[model samples]
Target: MGNPKQKWTNEEEEALRAGVAKHGAGKWKLIQKDPEFNQYLHSRSNIDLKDKWRNMAAAVQGSREKLRPPRPRPVQDVPAVPSVPLQTPTVVPAPVIHESPADHVKDESGKDLPDAKNGPRYTELIFDALKDQNAMDISSILAYIEKMSDIPVPPNFRKPLGARLRRLVQQEKLEKVESSLYRLKTNTVETNASNQKDTWPRPHPPALYTKVGESLEEAAKTAAYKVVEAENKSSVAAEAIKELEKFSKMAEETDSILQLAKDIFDRCTTHGEILLVA
Candidate 1:
């Protein structure tokens, strides 16, 4: 009857995280001993601490493949953009094809979503979203898109959206006020093929993927793994080889944290026990 078995709050979770960081995850007892942690988590048992850690770990290190970054821009399937940079795009010229209305994206209900006839471009959606707001980050944009549900998001859509945004910035359709936060350019108009420059740019982006807080070494490793992933999906050995060369040096310096994740991911993949985090 003491605390009425209150649910875990964000504060308690943060304290537990601090505890784990101070004294590795295994030493729950030590964590509980420290006032930094114990003061906030006194009611919880060591078992609860361990279990919470397990849940957090599982969530963070979900599928092994996801641990590997996808290729930048759209190189076939894997958008190859880091969660942090989510770089826009590069000028690689390719034939631009506009999607048709008849081929509108269908939802799970098998009904055509709104604005399906128009080309389902990422920039269009983002531009539309920011029309009213000042700026937004990827998470907010993603959440907004999910909530609106006007357009059906493709599977693993983040990379593609990032790639599109990068292209939009390149085309001067949008501007990045911050790394993640972006705003519509004052001069920018509704982006369409006619308004875009005639010079067709390479649709694919560079292979480099660097997270904001992560070391360059780790970023390089992510790029290499991503290249491997791209090769696996598209069977484009030549392209993968080319991209792999870009990150050749970075892949060799795997830190302890990355090494541990790799080991766990590899083991889980082998056992087919890796489930996509829901």
Candidate 2:
């Protein structure tokens, strides 16, 4: 006869869920081999794990169906009767509200399950978790978010949580300090420590100050040399100006001599004309 079928314990189910969350579904062998979950699921085979997960999923779906409210019946159109005038005015009624599918989905414990697809809320939750602590590993972050959340976090939440953290790190909104540890990008690692003081723009040593003073002295010497060079250039410019003035005087004298020679030539021509007439 076949061995008696063993019922799945809560610990085994939890371990299986954790394994599925970490390694992903369909990797039954890997999940079973995982050390973290092996203790709980050592006796369970891969086939058992797969069947158990399927059953769990089916049970959840069935419970959700049971919790779902029945659809409202459509009202058929009726012929209006002739109304008699009344002394009092008629009162209007409020519309009937129907529950959505999300509202009906609850865990076995009757707690509302958290939506893994809620990206913005998840982002806020991660930020809130890291804001209080200096740094936290992925597990701690997940635990903190779960503790603070009003709804029960799903077992597959770890997969989504890892993805969200990677996205945040990529976006530069969060910093990954180590392999699994994460913190806010803007937050310093030593923020929690009170004894540590900021030491930015550290003071220069006496030797550095002495070097700076020497540099200043060299700069002053350079400036003085430049001033001397400027004075020498000024002197050369003055000499050039004096030479120009001398050249100008020589040009004027040359012009006067040319004019005098022209006047002498004109007088000689006039005297020769006078002699030829005589």
Candidate 3:
């Protein structure tokens, strides 16, 4: 564990593979014994081999699971592995030398069909073209893409190639051998492949519970009905109280008027002035 937690670069990994291929598996000491064998991983040990293989196996298994859908398995199963080296070899893109600019490449109209997008882009095509060759320049790449592309070559294709190549170099997908000459980078493809990390497994939302008798709106309606009925009763009672108070005030006013009249009458009788009235 001398290099514990240290990420293995693609060059170091390739060296390990090449070492294993040259010497054979389970003979990491033979690969480590020779320094020139592992240029990037010369300091690695047999222990490193065991750890790296474990890590790679896990990575390959995980990658396969992601890329492929689950398939039905037979009840009878036999545990087997097809030569371990076959499992880990980098898939070299098949060489694409010729191009088809025939009418079949286009649709009914002159507006040509789309170039490769979802499967593989121009960059990948260029890399595949150069895989068997030594190196290539921007002119060579442009020519290749134009020939392979449908009917009419895309406008400003040369300008885009320069920019695309520069970007590829920046992304470490391609190496600039000279000023304009480029080649597919050996170490870049495998190193940052797992850069898009998987998100954490989120717990599902908590379950909600409710009684089955009534819905939320129905329950609210029932409560509102009770409140409205109580308010209506209270309003009727309040109106009755107000009517009683008004009647009492009128009776008091009538009593005061009668007392005044009685006083007037008593004074009139004392003065000997009694009148008969209808």
TM-score for all predictions?
0.28, 0.28, 0.27
Model 1 ranges off by over 4 Å: 1-121, 188-278
lDDT of 3 by residue, 214-235 (tens): 2223223333432332333343
Compare candidates 2 and 3 on lDDT and give the better one: 2
In candidate 2, residue 108 scores what lDDT? 55
Cα-lDDT of candidate 2: 0.49
> Mind sharing the TM-score for model 1?
0.28
Tens-place lDDT per residue, model 1, 1-278, is 56666677655665665554335456677767766566677888888887877665443333333656663433332212212123224321121233322232344432221111112343456766888687987666655665565554433344435545655676677788877887877774664754633232322322322222233344455555455444443433356564455334223322222422333444345566754755
User: Taking the candidates one at a time, how many backbone clashes does each contain?
Assistant: 10, 0, 0
Could you tell which candidate, 1 or 3, scores higher by lDDT? Answer: 1
Error of 2 at 271 (Å): 99
Q: Model 2 Cα RMSD, Å?
A: 47.1
Give the per-residue Cα lDDT of candidate 1 at 270. 50
The candidates, ranked best first by lDDT, are 2, 1, 3
Candidate 3: regions farther than 4 A off? 1-120, 193-278
Candidate 2, position 208, lDDT: 5
